[model samples]
Target: METVQSQSKNSSTDHHDHGGIFGEKTELYFAIISGFFFFLGLILSKLTPLPEWTSHSCYIAAYFFGGYYTLLEAIVKTRKGEFEIDFLMIAAAIGAAYIDSWAEGALLLFLFSLGHALEHHALNKATKSIEALGELSPKTALVRKGSTTEVVAVEDLKIDDIIIVKPNSQISADGVVIKGSSSVDQSSITGESIPIDKTAIAPNTKLPKFEEIDSSNVVYTGTLNGDNIIEVKVLKLSKDTTISRLVKMVSEVETKKSPTQLQTKKFEKWFVPAVIIMVVALSFAHLVIEETVRESLYRAISVLVASSPCALAISTPSAVLSAIARAAKKGVLIKGGRALEDLGSLRVIAFDKTGTLTEGKPRLTNIIPINGFDKNEFLEMVLDVESLSNHPLARAISKDINSEYGIENKHRSSDIQAIQGKGIRARYNGGNVFIGNVEMMKDAKITVGSEIHQQMDELLQYGNTVMLVGYNETLIGLISVMDVPRKLASQTLARLKKIGIKQMIMLTGDHQRVGDSIAKQIGLTDAKGNLLPEDKVKAIEELQKNNTKVAMVGDGVNDAPAMAISTVGIAMGAAGSDVALETADVALMSDKIQSLPFVIGLSRESRRIIKQNLWISMGVVALLVPATIFGFANIGVAVAIHEGSTLVVVLNALRLLRYDLKE
Candidate 1:
């Protein structure tokens, strides 16, 4: 088996891998040394005039190097009253030597050790996809101090320190770009196929609520700088960067065993001992049958080697780990194998409309001034009250007022207060100003004029959230804001449908009209509106009662319970919520809605590959066991077929690294 090296207790993440390597170089070097001595022994005996003792010495040296770690592990396991695949392999080689076939035994050890070396090299490359992410960040950064810049180690970089990211270099920390402009290759962090242009924002600009880092103004660690230089003020310490958190999450996920992997471990627990007992039976049965001990012993050893279960042990993990690494490299972080496998079997998928299906950011669409009030002055008053609150609609109004109306800060407000569930109130320019819904206007004892009332109803019917602007106890203006559906929402849902998801529904806390409007725009089959967090959970539970697996996709925190109960919980990277990123079963780091299909496609493919690998492995065993017992296969043929299947399982898993989502 390819796992001879990993059989050592010291070199593996899971000793029961039966056949896996973490790609350590020391084992590979020792395995090479073992092979060299084995070949030297063969050369001395066959082609050289060396004495027989010299050849024997070479064979002894080969066995010592090849069997050192395996022998140690077998002894340690025996003392504990345990059986390991390592002991099985050691028994096979020693039995061959007992039959006066030192050359055959030495050859077995040589090939086993060399097989482990090659497995180490190949599996190492497969696991390196994740290791490489941690390595993408530069070792050092150029920090600006006063008027001079000096090189500082990345770990030494502190918050609020100004760092200069020169052109064609990696950004060393996550920070806001206070100066300069450039495009960045954010694919490693955001999975954006195109380089995004990052322009500097004012140092004190207030970001929207729930945004982790400003996508347009903030540069993340490990993203490449473009042709122009940009100066970034570090927002977090080196260890707290997004890249570091992802690395930490990956480490945590590695320890979690998937259902199949747990089953495999249990299988190994009984299977190894059973194989040992079966070999013993074969060894003794030959005596009653009057067969020669050497021939019987050789066949039993061959069966032991043939049925090592190396390929079966690695079938799930190799594919699972490689798929995880591939996803992480592309900016999709699947927390563990459970999430990966769950993604494959989703029957019904529900989406949170606000951030998951539509752009969570709302934009002011229709601004109307009522009763001959000055439009600019009305907006100015509205902005004064709106700016005092951080509500989505208020922010949307402020953004439109500042960008479109281009108003100078003339109107000022005092005693501003936010009324929960209604809107905001403030005293502006010698009178009270209100910026909220109809309920807020009603609460303020202000009535909408007949014409303005008609328009508000029309906006509401069209799925717009209307903000009523009241001034001095009079209805002054109306601002309609709408959250646009994501550009890829329609296409992404269609892709999910094409991929055999039985149902797609939108779950939203927004009004039924608003939810249905967006759902229609995105071609979703159904929309459930005004759903509280608990309501969402109940909805998913109802779907599950129908014998369908439900997947809940949301902003992560608000949908946590629903996500917990669903078959899979997917968090959008756009949420920028740390709770969302750290807690979701799967996090779409790219924040691109189009990547959803890829997540499903890859997990399903990975599961299929695992099954294929298992069949290939067990199929080889099914044939080899019978053939070895019937005297049709010897140690060499068994080793060749058995180890060849292990390599095939590993190589098959590695193909996931090259898998790409089709457009």
Candidate 2:
């Protein structure tokens, strides 16, 4: 649904971002002049001795001010061979004047204009909130020159330029931390509840490409920095920052229409002409009964005013716009009304296993000691050897051990060596320690008993990589590790089910056991693995064969095909990636799983409000036309009721701006 809004002076982004709803002084002056003349003419012509034409001159002044934009819109629609509610409203107001109801005609245009202005004002408040997100990025950055730092415009900053971010300040651009350690609060851009710890990238660590990144070093524009200074190396130009991409998406929402809005447009195409035909037939039908021409035309004008369809034209877009703005505030970008409507009806949601479900890095899950070594003693041996190595597996093990035990590395290792096909080992505490696979332990003459072997077999079934630790040529412990599910993955799935999703599944390129292991941890109904992008699309098709609405959630690059096939394609971690922003129907800027349930609930709420607005608007017309025909209502009363319904629907749609799903 759409309406022709009369803009006062400027509709620029800066105007909407900072200015109040009243636009300028000219709008207020015109409104005051129109109301002053309308009331003066209505009372003077009735109570005092006044020439009728003189009173009409006052009414004409009211029409010129109040109906200026409405008349212009009506004329434009007419030249294009289109008829809208504005044209119908102006015609009915002029018909009232033909019967000498000049005061009532002025009242009609005044109320209609006021209703249109109010609706647009209310819609502006919702849109302004979405635009406010862009304002979070500061205009200037403290750029670091060779000797001293100089303040520069964010737009003037170039790639590879170093900028210094102060404590509790908004990040200036998309960049990486080169020096300093701090926790960057990404809630403004990514909606991650917790602030991410940011540290300078190590000199030895290989950095991933900007197109796909997950490092403690990466920082984005519009996110708040914690209480520490950080020197940032700009990775992107100012225009290509995540904040700019989001601003572009906000502008795009205006052009995209919901299915309901399109249907409303189709209804208006025929509804306007049909109302015109009915009014014409009614005029002649009264004349056939021998009623006077003036009286017949008068009644026809009343029906025309009653059947204006003002509320219907604005029913869907108002709600859709509000919902989109609300979702954007929560760090979820819904492309348009169609996606918002489709998301509400999602029956199945398929998740990509790597980044969507798991944290995409191996984490230690279990550590079991064998023989005489206690758990801490076993971990101390494992940490001492693994911390010296640089393998990915070794890093995973050492990180987990350091996080859990806070080991100070009491024993200084002397002979540390990384076996080519196996893991690493070192001499520590006057004893030889080994950390590797079962084959490495066995090759070193360490006993692998039935109990330890059975334990390793059980861990393998859950898709865990078991690493054996040995000391003095004896078995010490086994450490099981794998990529673990995200912290909120299981809770998010349960919340989705609570909101009426029927099934949850996982589609991934990982092994079947790994996929199932993640599914079990995250409460998914099914898990499918060893699937390429094409296979994911086929899986989406298979789910859709049951005629259910399916949604695909992924990191948004490899899963684009699957997302295209699903009913709703949601991209996770879209804050800085352009491919994710452009590909998915819904882009969750934050990589948090918690946002999934929130977006789903919001879409459902918006859909419900749109349906409710339709009912309220159509229901008013059902009661209105018959009352006007039976002489139970006059032109003044019908005009008042029509504008009243318009205001009612607008206020109802505005309810979505403050909508929140309480868990």
Candidate 3:
């Protein structure tokens, strides 16, 4: 787990993060230092015995303390052969100092510093909920040995280790409940407010029901252990756990950006130069007509200072920050501004079948056996083979077989081979034994009869993937695995439709039946199956070619490439993969699938606000610049309107904060 670092005790925004030394502490120190010098300048200037030079010295000190970073940044930009708003601000303020308007210069520095501090505060506040989730992550897990318990780093916990979870402690890992029951506070994970009552037989067993574990039986990392202690078997370790992945994903999201945000930078490349031209023209005209160079320059500086686009600069990010803040409040962590922009434009949302729409756990749904073999014999032999394998399908077959026979398979064989996209082959009892689907058996020249084919068709109708196992060229038994759709999957898809998304589809690496089953259940119009990561990307490209702005939502390591290819790549169960988070444009913190629509709606609303702010700012600037040149407006009026418009733009952007987004 990453620590959130804090340097000063008095600091309001000190949380340890993995962002190294340049996080909250550095920002706070700069703001505090600037604040100190500002008051120091004011105080030293009032000393009775001090000469003018000493007062000037205090102003210089204030500038160094308050404006040093800005000055250095501006000079660095100059070295890079690019001029920015920083250069313009510094030039105007230095000119104020040259004219001996020390108060004006100091005021300029003070206001700018205050703005910087506020921006930092706003960003800090925006990320607090996400950081809070990180802070609440468990550092240690309890290892239970017989009747004794030992605490160790969460990373040290292993699979099937029974861990004791005390009341109010963070659940240290994801695991099944072998024993105890309690109500778990899953609000952090699901954005659901109330505690969910977890029992012995809660739904979806492979992935532990973090909501249903008996307070006495199971615990999950980042979930609050309830009023009653729970005993749980850890199925995954700390680094591989869901919470750890989410924290890292959130960190990586700061860098995964949206296309619109990048385009906005390009927009600035042109917009900034045009604004400079307007500011220059206003100043030149004032000098020619008014015959007062000093007044003209001051008015010109005010125009530049007013039209600096600082408000416009913050315009896009403010909506982005607000969207992210709103999403975090709802347990959705969108990575950056661009993701928010793209979410608003989504026309099609392609979901992965395994985890995005399905529950991702397989169950034995059907079985078919050849004439010489009964269902039991076939199951027993396949379970014998599956018992030695660790794949999800293997574990599922084993679990189903063991439950039926009440005996664990102990048979072992050598030289086992798995055929990609098919099944397994092994040597057992001095004969060729196959323990996979019909494709695997057929490749080995095993005979398939009409009965097996009929049964396979029946299983396919029910959306089961049937595997035919054979020995000595004769079919032994058939194994079928079915993945259940998520309970809310269809409802979530319908909600997206309500939010104006026209196309909803499912993409999977599973067979066509498996994919189609889930797609139909979720009411999707299209379902593509047996796709690799590259195939998924190709599908996204095809959708985009059809003029559909597609968003691919997935949470697996395999889904990362497709996520990167989509117009907006959204990661479901975001805390599972760093690559998914790093590559995907948006992240859902927990398993609740409904927030996708909420975030999309919020983005559309945010874009509306951004457009409003941009128009209002531009409209006022267009009107006021001409008004100032013709003497219809004085310098003071222009400054007031200019500052007033900045405030108006900010307040208009703030309207996004009031949006209602709930499940």
Candidate 4:
């Protein structure tokens, strides 16, 4: 029952906070200050001929200043029996000091602290998108209380409260418009750059309610309103807003470790103990061979510092964070390192028909009159009845009819009803008007003649969804609608093939012919249609049975279960729906198919960089440990090589930040 503020506070206090210990600035400040003292000590010891105690004092001071937090963390983790990179670095530095190499120890601490600071800064920058989203919604809302409007904190606003949003202001909560009209920029939520026009819904219409959130009548939190005042009745509280859910998802994503990262952690558990044993054995060997304690101890300390797996530990997370940030900037949200890695190895990708490859908005494509009926009269009647329904096809037909003939309803129909998955039924002009799929006609016992059936077949062949319109007992006409493929859908599929995807399939609930037609148009390798949500899940499982890694792309409530069962679930246009964002492992914030290619390419590159980093880290340790034992490298040189490799691996991962789809 914690409030949002308390939840945020607790999350910030967790170890994964982007800005650690006060903030990035404080970490940077301490690193710089400690580096100055370390350099001063180096100058006194090597160049100034100052008293040894003076230089020793300065080195001790530098070590404590630069490594205090790291030392504290090492102790805390050690007490909990979890030895990490901090423990390794601190142990190495202290071992150098134990061997009277104060200058080398001080320098090691300073460089390690600097690298930690830089890593934090880079990670914080990468996660800034989530913070930016959190800031988009207004903190206060103007509530319309009786005759006067009063400003109140968004958290205090309740469901069903009417809030007034002015032009250019961010919405305070998710709600439905009750009055006025405007174009709202929902880019923060849906990643659609174009502002969508929204108007008030008519009272008591058969149209789906605002809870389903039709774009024309629903306004979401964090969207910017255009130049018109609108009254919105809140549907959700501030904590339950779409933006809040999005931020929460982004924050939790980093905690889900990738397979590679988990493997690296497992290696480190064994690697750390082995390194300690090696250091002890090397110290014993050196003492027996050379019989000089100072040099023997120094060599062992150098081995400890050189063989630390800092780079290996950082490899996957740094690359994953950078890629996630890059993808976020382009309106793609990679849920975690696991999804990013899996995307690289996907052999097959299954896509839902609606809202993934195609624009979910259908348009009126054709109208056919039957039994010598007048086309315009049939259209007018169909529009009148369909206007009362909230189906996408109905809206498209109504829009086209309204635009073409300037038809306006003179009177409201009575007893309007929606037959789920079929059509609409209502009383118009003292007679019954039916508009829906062919199933509705069959259910009503209306006979469709051979010629009309032929016409319907022709429409279906072209991937059009045909709706039957009947007046009383006789069929009057047919309305055909099509949801067209996105402009870049074909190009995206081609790119996926070129990137080594072996199979691409379309799965849908639409008619088989309609699905096949769209699949062919988009150049998919295969298509499966007439699927219920469970059918799609079975289809995904069938694909996986062949040992193919599958990714399912969809954006609907029905798609959720199938998406969950797939190897990876990608939600399209997820910014619009909290459920979509939460349900999928990855989310395309914008309704753009092109982002698919970019994300896949980025994942492959991340995997490549991770492998390269691991090789470099293990190679350096393999070479330097033997070299330090055989008297080829000194303590200072070993520390330099180790910290430098860590920096190189980090910088290599940062390359993902500049990766672009256009490139």
Candidate 5:
């Protein structure tokens, strides 16, 4: 089977090829060439003692140089029965030329073409984050084949192939380290600035198994290696690497238009035809009123030039793309313009308990020994049995036992079994050992005394998950685990409220007391407890039914349904999980909750800019159309106003690229 490493490499190359088509150099070249001819035509017409016919020839040449590409695009679009801004500009220019105003026609085309070039340049700048990510993977890698290292193209390295990453070089593919250690920078993927220390595991040691690979042992594509040389066994192909998926997601986002963009497009369907009809009607009306043919045609052409919706067409995409790019730089991946627009309208945000608000790492908080059992010995036995389990609470207990009491998994326990939603059971030293919740103890016929029950209640009251340990039908001890709230939880809640989030709710499968405790601590507006996965989905549905736009944030597995049902699904710390990256509408690359507020602020700002651009574009057209009909505006002034409004809209959208959370 081909390894993920090989797939990742191939996909990376393909994504890079896709990105290559968007470079700004081509647009800059066209703009420069068009500007040069425009100046030459102006010099010939006004300053030089050239013949009138020669000046007119110069103007025609300027028009061809400035607008040939746009004219061809318009023709292609026309054949497809779609009318765009290019078609509008070309038609207006033709009308000006027919009115014996060749100079004005040439100038209008030059400005219109220049606007197209600038818009392309601005879009390129806005989507630079995706392009920058594509560039991070190195072209070649040092592969070790049977004790000999040879440089090979990254795409040529297959799964299980060993590659040596030298100091200061980007890792060519995603792999697990089999030899050496290094401090690697993963900011490109996770957005964390600090370098992480990674070490190779011993050959004989069984690595801890989890849903996601541990960051310390896994090296990903495009991450920079530090001073130490490390050998990695490639686990994923280039195309399937974390960076490749991230790049692909960012690229796909631009194609999904926002609500505002869709509205403008709907308006454009009839708006373009209306403008043409208006111009024709105005010209016929002027002729009926005994106006001269030349004067009647001039006013009609002015109306055509003045009514082009160039600014309106560009308003939403420019703002959305710029906002999306800004979010990416901060390690927040907004999947599309739809998510970007939806985020701004969210009145309620639902968060999953574990891994969203809480750190998700449980800790052993309390231990109560019973029946005169040796505290240390009981703890040691619990560690040995739990060592065979992969549950988060089991790992936390084992880690605590190892650290606090120097206990290790040395005992051989047979018949080990996991009880779903309850706990674990194993036969140790020919005695039945049970470690689980209150339900497990009851099922095993272990009687809990008042003292034991009181201890459990106190722990539950404090929001800790209590586990009972029994030996051969006798209650031995009580253990409590607590998954604490993240350090930034309260701060994140405060910022959300400050930014106009009307409600924040947390949903969890933990006991109601536990859920309420964490919710109170984090200042959540509401908390729902003991909810199954389906229950969470129902909660999200309830919020939506109230006409509240909701964003559901979670770790992206058990919460996937709930997130999918909401207006937007945001995955927290999604850098390690492909499912989370793909399933969520928005993925926070890092684990910092503060990024939530920052994203909200960005969305609100983008929405504001889109509104401003729309008003400006439509307002300009509204005022100029009437002025042209009354002869208050000429063709030159109309074209100037139209082109200037387009530029203003583009510049306004570009402001989102510089948006910062500190503002």
Candidate 6:
């Protein structure tokens, strides 16, 4: 059955870890209950010539006590049209009862229950490393209103709300300090294990230290407030906060199957039927040649039990669970097991242009003023118009103008009209300022200088998309804003290629120049640009048609459809939009592109482990079936071997929990 969380809980390791604890407790409860019935049956069987009816009742009770859950699960699965290992085990148990081996039936259930308990316990221990992740913001924030402190839910906060931070309190929102200084622990957010000192940071200054204790003017989310009391103005609300975004991204990591998982499923389709046929044929031949139907039937049951698909059934999930836990340790959250399995077979990975490979946030990479206009004047004009707009280019222009010119545009604009898909038109300084793309300026009859065109063209070569901001009939300046590449992007791409990835491709909605520039920088073999979400899906389908398994990496609404269409979809959880995260097959919890190779390595290792376990299980069945049929092994030994095979398969699959990858 599919399981989904009812509420958007804090993305904590606790949410996932608690499921294991639940399973473990349930197992222990079942085991204890089964043991009680087993003892009761033993007592009743020997007590005072107990009636045949009474003895049978006790035996049945003991059998049902241990196997009832399995029976229920089998029925549920039947309704769902999936006949699984649980059904096979139930059939085996009932067959033992039919053979008048009541005690043996009870014993088999007991052993199976015990094995389940052990598996849950082991799985719980293996996943313990992920328990610390998903710690959320403290439920409450200390809001400071004119020096009076009051506690409130973090979600209730609004922009510019002044919040107070006490020593050792987790910072509730992303904000800047208005007062005080202290050292903050930021290890949770940045993976640095040091307390950073934060003095009042100016609006635009140098980078803050990773760690130093001076909480005077520091601001970061999920970091500890130092020993000094400080006031902060909230820059973003809870839903828009960094941790909130991360939690959302984590929740959405891709859940689709990778190529390996699909192959495993396909293999099982054939492997299961073939093994069943072989087991039936060998048993029936022995029945025709050997003396007793009882012995032959027993041999057949042993073969069936020995060749149980439990190992195969368990292989993919165990390996994937282990891989996900390992990723969590490194600050990555892969949502589904299928995604981990598919990541290994990815031949080409398409990336979303805006955010997946680059910092989604655009910055002013270049600002060129034309026609003898003073750069500052051009900047002021553009910034004044852009400050009134919310487009990415506008924001980038605003941030750049403020950073470079040391002036905040306080002058208000009148009659601002934002043209959809073009630019913003506003009355500034008694003139119409058109700050937008060339289309916008052309529509407004604005002409740009030749030098500005040359500068814009040059910016495109470096992977930047330039926006033209013009006044009246002349272009004021060209603001070159590009999606910033991730710091580890180049090295991450190189590592991906080294891991046997061929035909690297990049897909984006941006212009061709931007896509080509990024593709070249990242050593891509090909690049596609100006693609919509559906277009991305077509590209993935094309790759599949050409026999190239592809993984699409994206971080926006536009990537959601492509993610669902790819062989493997990797969502950039660190910067991904909520829909992208929820739809992708695998999500990299952090914005680290390097984890792609790590995931692939883990999947390949897991697939190998699954194959090894299946063979081991089959080998046990092959050896035990012959011994039972030839009268070399008694019912006792046969039963032991049958049960032991199951145990061996389980133990082999458990090895995936500690399986290490070279990546």
What TM-score would each prediction reach against the true structure?
A: 0.61, 0.60, 0.60, 0.63, 0.59, 0.60
The predicted structure with the larger lDDT, 3 or 5, is 5
Give each model's whole-structure lDDT. Answer: 0.73, 0.73, 0.64, 0.74, 0.73, 0.63
The window of 10 residues in a row where model 6 has the poorest summed lDDT is: 1-10
Clashing pairs in 4: 189-575
| Greater-lDDT candidate between 1 and 4 | 4
395-469 per-residue lDDT for model 1 (tens digits): 677888899879765648889886644667888877888887888898889986677778878788767878788
Model 6, runs deviating above 4 Å: 1-87, 96-300, 309-317, 331-338, 369-385, 390-392, 403-448, 461-463, 467-477, 574-579, 635-663
Q: When superposed on Cα atoms, how far off is each prediction in RMSD? A: 12.6, 10.1, 14.8, 10.3, 12.6, 14.9
Clashing residue pairs in candidate 2 (N, C-alpha, C atoms within 3 angstroms) = 1-261
- Clashing residue pairs in all predictions, respectively, total 0, 1, 19, 1, 16, 26
The predicted structure with the larger lDDT, 2 or 4, is: 4
For model 6, the local distance difference test gives 0.63
Error of 3 at 48 (Å): 18
TM value for model 6: 0.60
Model 6, 490-575: lDDT tens digits are 78788878888877788776667777888888777888876644566678778888677778887765566566667776788877
Better of 4 and 6 by TM-score: 4
Residues 315-345, model 3: lDDT tens digits: 5555666767888888887765546767888
lDDT for model 4, on a 0 to 1 scale?
0.74
Give one digit per residue, the lDDT tens place, for model 4 in 73-118: 5676678786666677788878878867777677667766655554
Give candidate 4 regions above 4 Å deviation.
Answer: 1-86, 96-262, 309-318, 370-381, 388-393, 403-447, 458-464, 470-476, 509-514, 528-542, 545-547, 557-567, 574-576, 643-651, 660-663
Candidate number achieving the greatest TM-score relative to the actual structure: 4
Best by lDDT: 4
**Per-residue accuracy of model 2 over 205-254 as CA lDDT, tens digit each:** 66678755555688988788876789998999888887676555444543
